[model samples]
Structure formats: C-alpha cells, structure tokens
Target: MYINSSETAIIALLEKIKSLEEPDSAGIFYNAFIVILDAFVQPFSITILVSLVVLLVLLFFSAMVSGSEIGFFSLGPQHLEKLKQSTSGRGKLILKLLERPKRLLATILIANNFVNVAIVILSTFIASQWFNLSSFPVLAFIVQVVVITALILLLGEILPKMYASVYPVRFSKSMAGVLNVLIKMFYPLSSILVRSTSFLDNRVARKSHVLSRSELSD
Candidate 1:
C-alpha cells in the first residue's frame, strides 16, 4: 500500500511538469505579455517626447524674455553676482522679468503666434499634395493646430512659468551660467531691438502730448 501511494504522488508531479512544458500554452502567454507591453509602452514613449520638446521650447522663450528684461533693468554688478550665487537664480531672473507681467505675457503671445503661423503654413503646403481627402485633411489640420496650441500654452507656458515663479531664485541660480552665456551672445541684437522699441514708444508719446496741447490751446 505505501509503495502504491508513493507511485501515485510521483505520477501527479510528472503530469504538472508536462502541462507547464506544453509549447502552445506557453507561447500564447508569452505573446499576450508582449502585446500588453507594447500597448502600454508606445503611448508613454510618445507622450514623454512631446512633453520634453514642449518644455524645452518654453524654457528657451522664458530665457530669452528673462535675458532681455534683465538687460533692460541693468542691475549693479554686486547684486548680479549675488544673484548668480543664489539657488534657482536663472528662474529668479525670469520671475523678475515678470514683474511687468503684462509685457512678458504679450511678448510670449506674440512669439508663439509667429512661430505657430509659420509652422502651420509650412505644414499645410507640405501635406497638401499627400492626401486626396477633400475636407478631412483641412479639418484635421485645424484640429491639430488647436491641440498643439493648447498643449503649448498649458504644458509649455503656464506650467513652467508657474514653477519658475515658485522657485525663481533656485532656478535662476542653477541656470545662471547658461543664461549668462546666452544673454551675452544675443546682447547686441537684443540691445538693438529693445532700444528701437523704446525710441518708437517715446516718439509716439511725444506726438500724443503735442496733439493734446494743441487741442487744449484751440
């Protein structure tokens, strides 16, 4: 009786191993896992790339505005040096530029509009001949424009600006070197642009004042 029972247990163990070794079942499970992995990974990869691109574009604009405004303010060397030492100093510089929030916002809006329009025109021309759909392509293009614009404004502009505002000092300090290099490189052109703008504004104001004076006299 004991030998019979031992043989029965061995037979059950062998059957379990055989079932696990079956090629069809194992292959099906393996393929299912692969499909699941691909489904999960592909969208995530695209999302990450898109986010990174948007963030970089926003940062570039933020840096440009920060550099130009910091140039305009003309802080003393001592304060500037101290700012360079602080944490998030680069972000801080950006926030400081936002002191005139309206102007900074206007600059960003104008820059975004210019870039998006150029991109749309180029994309439309390139895609026009590829697709034969009458109105679908145009509708798709409009949708793409809206989605990209919203993504840029939200992920690129609002989020980064908010984060920089929260930790300006640290951000500015961290990016100080990079910002300094960029500012220096673009200084000549930025100077020319800023000065020209100021000159034009002053002229307009003067003309407005002169017209008001003449009207008052009459």
Candidate 2:
C-alpha cells in the first residue's frame, strides 16, 4: 500500500509538470514569431515612418543652409561688428540672415513642399487603386481627402516645423553636428558634385551674357 501510494503521487506530479511545459512551448514559439514579424514589417509598423524620412531630409537641407550662413557671418565678423556699431546693433543678425540664409531657407521650403505634394498624390493614387473604386463617392471622397490632407499637414509639415520653430537653436545645433559628420563621410563625392555644379553655373552665366548681347544688337 505504501509503495502504490508513492507511485501514484509521482505520476500526478509528472503529469502536472508536462501540462505546464506544454503551454510554455507554444508561448515561446508565438513570441519568437512576433519578434520576427516585427523586424520584417518595420516600414509598415507606423504611418509616420515615411514622413519622418522626408522630415529628416528637409532637416539635413536646413542644416546645410545654416552652415552656409555661419560661414558667411564668420567671414568678416569684424567688418560686421563695425557696421553694427555704426547702425542699430539689433538689425545686424536679421540683415545677415536676410542676405543669405533666408534664400537658402526658401529653397528648402520649396523642395520640401514639392516632396510633400508628390507623396500626397502618390498615396491617393495607390489608395484609389487598392480599393478598386471607379470613382470615389462624394462622402467617401470627402473623408479620404480630409484624412490624407490631415496626415500630410500634421505629420510631414506642421509638426516638424513647429518643433523646429520652437527649438530652432537647439535643433539647428544638433543638426549641424550630424551634417558635419555626414559631409565628412561623403566628402569625396560631395566635392566632385560641388565642383561640377559650379563649373556648369559659370558656363550657363557666360552663355546667358552672350545671348543678351546678341539680342541687344539685333
């Protein structure tokens, strides 16, 4: 009787252990699959990923403009100081930015806007195709339009601009450091492109002058 009771107790304990381990095996497998899926589906995980990439590109361009402005301002800081001393000191920074940085910023804005527009158009087109709707009904169209516009405006433009505007100095400084590293990494290719662009601009300017002279003579 003692031997039989001990054998029964052991069997019960073994069965309980097997039951607990069975659930854990499936749980582990499920967790492993989830991790793999998350890794593979990164791009689809969030709607903002694409917008973030665009924003980063815009920020990079902005950093380049800031760098160029810094270069111009530092070129003759003493001269600028003398001018500032002669005039109202308050307008000096504004004037310096207006002379160069503003133009660079405007170019960046134009590029950013163009990219945003392209993204909106492409997204709408793809959505339309995916839904297989011949023409969007009025209500559905309105909703689609609003949703798409809101996404682009909020995610791509307003949010980033607001953040940058509120913390311009900090953001610019950080971006400047990043851009410096990137420029160093790509210096060889960047130098070639810069030189080629400069050469082309000079050639275009000469041609334009010659054409203007010919037009005046005629």
Candidate 3:
C-alpha cells in the first residue's frame, strides 16, 4: 500500500474536522438539556412576572374591545330608544359612535388586532424567558396555537360578545367612554379604512348592476 502526501494531508484534515464537530454537537445538546432542566427548576424573574401581568391586562382590554363590536352594532330600535331617552353621558357617546358605523367598526377591528398582536409578542417573550421553545416543537405549537388561541377565543371573543349581545345597551354604555377616546385616537386610520371599504362597495354594486342589465338584455 502506497499513500501519497496529498492523501495523508486530506486524512488529517478530515480527522481534525470531525474532532471539532464532535465537541460542538455535544455542546448544543448539553445546552438544550440545561435549558429544559432550568425551565422546571428556576423561579420566574420579576420582569417575567411583570410581563405576565401586562399580558393579562392586555387580554382584559382585548375582551373589552371585542365586546364593544357586538355591543354597539347590536343596538336595536329599543336600545336606541333607551339611549335617546337617557340623560347619561355614556348614552350620548354611544349614540355618537353609532352615527358613523363604518368608522366605528374600523376602530374596533384595528384596536382588536393591535391588542392581539401585543398579546402574542408578550406571550412569546415570557415563554422564551422560561423555556427554549425552539428546542421543543410540540410544546411550542401547543403554547402558541392551542393555549393562546383558546384564551383569545374564550376570554377575549366568545364570552364578551355573548354578554354584549344579551345586554347590548348596557354593554354599549359601559364601553362607550373608552371607545369614544379610541375613535378619536384612531380616527385617521379608521377614516382611511372606511373610505376604502366604501369605494370597494360602490365598485361591487356597479359591477353587479352591469351584470344584471346584461342578463336582462340577453
């Protein structure tokens, strides 16, 4: 067996590369294990605790904004009459908000989306602090999809909307002040969205009318 100098050099290089990779691979596994261990053992930090509190607060606001959508929009003839007769400031605000339905809907949607995004970001931050979510795909999916979605659906969407629908007038009045401020604050965004939707509606109506006329002629 005759081996050349180049072959010897290649073998040495391969050996060195394998030696380097072995430690790196071990280090990665070791670090991941340590992270999993600490997730169970360590107490949450003050920052994490505070973020969790903020997350809960955001969820509360999410519930309020989501409820307001049903509350204001579900107001019936009777509900309007109540607001019309009431001397309360909130009733006045509710009436004012309803005066512009498109803008009101836009504001509610924008606020809901903004709060939901904040909830996700804060939740991710808290989870990352506690565990290496990237290392556990199943757990990550459960937390991000199942747990978070359930929380939003149950607390932020379903329950509030149910309550609002059942007591539209009361819910509308209770949420009116906050929504009044939000409508002003989000006016620019809501206005743009309202205009865009109106334009789309007009275009769709014209297209439908043209189709109907064509069908009649045929």
Q: Per-residue lDDT of 1-218 in model 2, one digit per residue for the tens?
A: 44443344445545555566456766656654654343222333234555446545644454344343343334355545554665643335434443644343433344445556665665565444333233336634754588767766665656655565555443444444443444455556555655666789799999999999999999
Clashes of each: 15, 0, 0
* Ordering by TM-score: 3, 1, 2
Using TM-score as the measure, the top candidate is: 3
lDDT of 1 at 117: 57
Ranking by lDDT: 3, 1, 2
Per-residue lDDT of candidate 3, residues 1-218 (tens digit): 98643345446545555566455766656554654464432467998889989999999999999998998999889889988999998898888888999989999999999999999888877877765556457888788778888998899999999999998888888889898899899999999999999999999999999999999999
Candidate 1 per-residue lDDT, tens place, 1-218, comes to 44443344445544545566555766656655654343222333554555456545654564444433333334445555566566754645654653643344345345445555554454443333332223355665664576556655565456655665655445444544554555455555556656677789899999999999999999
For lDDT, candidate 2 versus 3, the one ahead is 3
Kindly report which residue stretches of model 2 are placed more than 4 angstroms away from their true locations once superposed: 1-99, 174-218
TM-score winner between candidates 2 and 3: 3
Off by over 4 Å in 1: 1-135, 208-218
RMSD of each: 16.1, 17.3, 10.4
lDDT of 2 at 5: 32
